[model samples]
Target chain A: MAETTWRPASARGAGGATATTRAWRVWSSAAIVTAVVLAVLVVPPVVNLDEQAVHLADKLLPPSWEHPFGTDDVGRDLLVRCVYGLRVSLLVGIVAAVVATVVGTAVGALAAACGGWVDRIVMRLVDVFASVPHLLLGIFIVAMFRPGVWPVVISVGLTHWLSTARIVRAEVLSLRSRPYVDAAISGGASRWRVTVRHLLPGVLPQAGLAAVLMVPHAIWHESALSFLGLGLPTHQASLGTLVQGARSSLLAGDWWPTLFPGLFIIVPTLAIAGLAGAWRERINPRRRSELML
Target chain B: MLELRSVTAGYDRRDPVVRDVHLTVAPGEAVGLLGPSGCGKSTLARVAALLHRPDRGQVVIDGEVARGWRHRAPRAQRTAFGVVFQQPRLSADPRLTLTQLIAEPLRATGRAAEVPGRVADLARTVGLGDDLLARRPHEVSDGQLQRACLARALVLDPRWLICDEMTAMLDASTTAALVAAVEGYRARTGAGLLAVGHDKVLLERWCDRTVHWDELSGDAAADRTT
Candidate 1:
């Protein structure tokens, strides 16, 4: 008898989401899978090609079957360099995002759970952090350390955690007000127990969503730092380094070098963002019905 | 015994909802708290349950004054009473199965080993089918979920029970089932109860005595007789 009452709206074909959202979800999932597969399987072998092996004879080669993304001014394979650059950018972005998410979730949960002067102090700290432009702060932090992956990751991770903290704090505050949480408290669960068992689990998905969404931003932050010559050393083939190296070639009218690396950065960023959007839609109870379609 | 002594409480301390309310329920007694909607009956109920701290006045349990509210409350004091809120859906962890939800307090208090047995026993008592034990709140009807909530409230064998408009959202059959379940638990445990709602006939039928909100607060008697 209960079964008859819970026929999901999607099952009844009466959900609110339109075909456009449905299409977007499909495309987003596909893009994410394709990007991950490329990063894992294809990029590794492509990156093995000698990025610094210059061939003056083959300099500024345009897109051809022999040199797909064309050769750079140093005559090194642009395709190989771009693939290597993408791998580095993804590695930094993912690591930095994870760091930011962990810090944010902890801060957010602590601030909310304590809920007094602690909440106020933490929120004020978050505001202080948010007031600074991420890029500007990131540049200063990165400039302090040696030009490498760790410095860029640290800068991006530190600079980007404010939003996730704010998001997580908001989520925790709302969850705390929930009757279930109140019920848990009334049930003799200690403050620590309620936090660990109920509050943490409740905020995890929102934190995860925040983490996924932050990946593209982290990537962009890393790329910007690298472009400003304050990130990864020029010897390393990050997407930003490749773009920076292509400035001269671009001026000489060999646009392929700059364009290809730029494309590499944009495509994966959009793909990750798309995946995050689809994930957000899936977790939302109202939109979850739409996913079945 | 459960007692609220001259309790004045609300979301805002300065502008209290229920002022200087005094009420009590001895063991084995069922007291209905009758009030119109927005009369602060629910807020008073929360105070009685120790889920909310009154702006003023004491909540005495079994002649002992209650000191803390929520998780800070002593385990013996906190676990002595079980509260069933109005919305079973909102009062339940949506992700947990019915069995898990019913067994929550047991696990919360480090009695994990007793969960399966207690949950099974309560399920049977609440008339929850074996098949329904594995379902989430969204999978069940409001009535079915309320049954689970009743089972949960009684699972710990609490000395006191507070049902704050628990049946307000349910159909007649479900409400009767829940009331009967509460009655069975009370009969077995001799637990005191504070049933808060505006349903006069239902309260009159289920509770030993019904008290008006204004009467409890010592206000000038209004036309609150149902």
Candidate 2:
């Protein structure tokens, strides 16, 4: 291995993989979809909505030709407020989801693969987290840390990964029993090779599904935290804070402020969760077929 | 040479499947192990093949204790032995084709550039034709999958081969063909073989010497005759 840096044999074109379809799913096929998801995700942060432009003269206007969603209290455009709120929500969702999934998958793989006290301890920790209310934990995390994107990300990301970890642990447990892993290890293939080649390819689909599902959870958590003033500061408007701020106007019958931002939150949460199912089917070869999307 | 000294291994702590077993396969020699269905010969082969960690006992290979299990053996040590299981389809990765499967050890040894040629050569040696190389595990029959698994096992040109019930699922005709392939491989490479099988005639025919699982164990009253 010293004289020549080892390349994985598949890279040598020995198998002619493209010539036929194999049992495992191909991740690269999702490049088009993931790219589109990324593009839409990138849009929220870059497209500034000038949410802070307050016009006292144009205060409390209803949805009209000038403002599609109308103006909010203190005369900020509801469209701008909802959009900037979406920006913060997406940032928190994406970042927190990634961190949670990566950590969860790694921990789950280790706990299940190692098996014994390590497995017991990890599962017990998961149980502990499960027993506690996620909202309470998220609140505690935000309050303990500085109020910013990181805190929201950490709170939402950290609390939400238990499901992913549990899911991966179960999958890895079954995968460990599969003869291919044993064959690979027994054939003197290094543990790393067995893990990277055999184990992870199997675990990734479920883990990925969890990560996608986590986005909505993170977004919701961030919004909720911001509602309680534990999420992003009042100066930086997120979906949660925007909705929270509109609570007063809601009772006054000026419902546009609450209604518009709330739609932004609900619509995205539903869309992401719905899309997660299709994403799951597309990535798993056994389930891959003409999805009626 | 491969040696097992009182090697005992089991999945459960209360009941050891293979206990206090002693066996050896000399260099360039073919040996056969036969027993009833549940006599623990497969576990013994697994231990000798450096796949299973023994509870107590040592596996000495070519005068050194084979450093496998926890600490990895050197590249030379790793390439010195090949182990094949009874269920070829189960052992082989369904995701990979025969070519990629056969080329795994070569890839591990940093000789990935030689994989295509090596895969073809191994295919010929194992009686797996060139066209079967592109097919997945499910695409082939049990016989063909066995041949692919055998080719993969021998790809590293291992000095020793451990085949545990390798032909149990094959038809009589396929078994004959597989035997010929094993024989051909041995003739060319002079590799040692430890083959376990249910067929007494095949074992007797292929191996230089045949030993029963009872003979290797410490049990005094194992009265079954072969």
Per-candidate local distance difference test = 0.85, 0.79
Off by over 4 Å in 2: A1-49, A64-68, A113-132, A144-146, A277-293, B66-78, B129-131, B220-226
Give interface RMSD, per candidate.
1.0, 2.4
Worst 10 residues of 1 chain A by lDDT: A284-293
- Give the CA lDDT, 0 to 100, for residue B110 in model 2: 71
Model 1, A1-293: lDDT tens per residue?
A: 55664434553321455556657655976776587657746867755667678899998899999999999887888887887888888899999999999999999899999999999999999999898888999999988988899999999999888878888888888888888887887777888888888888988998998898888888888888898889999879888888888998888898998999898888777777767766776787454432110
Docking class of 1: medium
Please state the error at residue B120 of candidate 1 in Å.
1.2
- How does residue B25 of candidate 1 score in lDDT? 95
Query: What are the candidates' individual DockQ scores?
Result: 0.62, 0.27
The TM-score that candidate 1 achieves is: 0.90
Off by over 4 Å in 1: A1-29, A32-36, A46-48, A281-293, B221-226
After TM-score superposition, the amount by which residue B200's alpha carbon in candidate 1 deviates from its true location, in angstroms, is 0.9
Worst 10 residues of 1 chain B by lDDT: B217-226
**lDDT digits (tens) for residues A1-293 of candidate 2:** 56976656443321333312322223333443354355456655686446687799998899998888888778888777776778778878989999999989988888887788999998899999989999999899889988889988988888888888888999989987776665666556776777777777888878888887788888888988999988988768789988888898889998888888898887666666646645664566344333211
Per-candidate fnat, comma-separated: 0.79, 0.37
TM-score for each predicted model, relative to the true structure: 0.90, 0.80
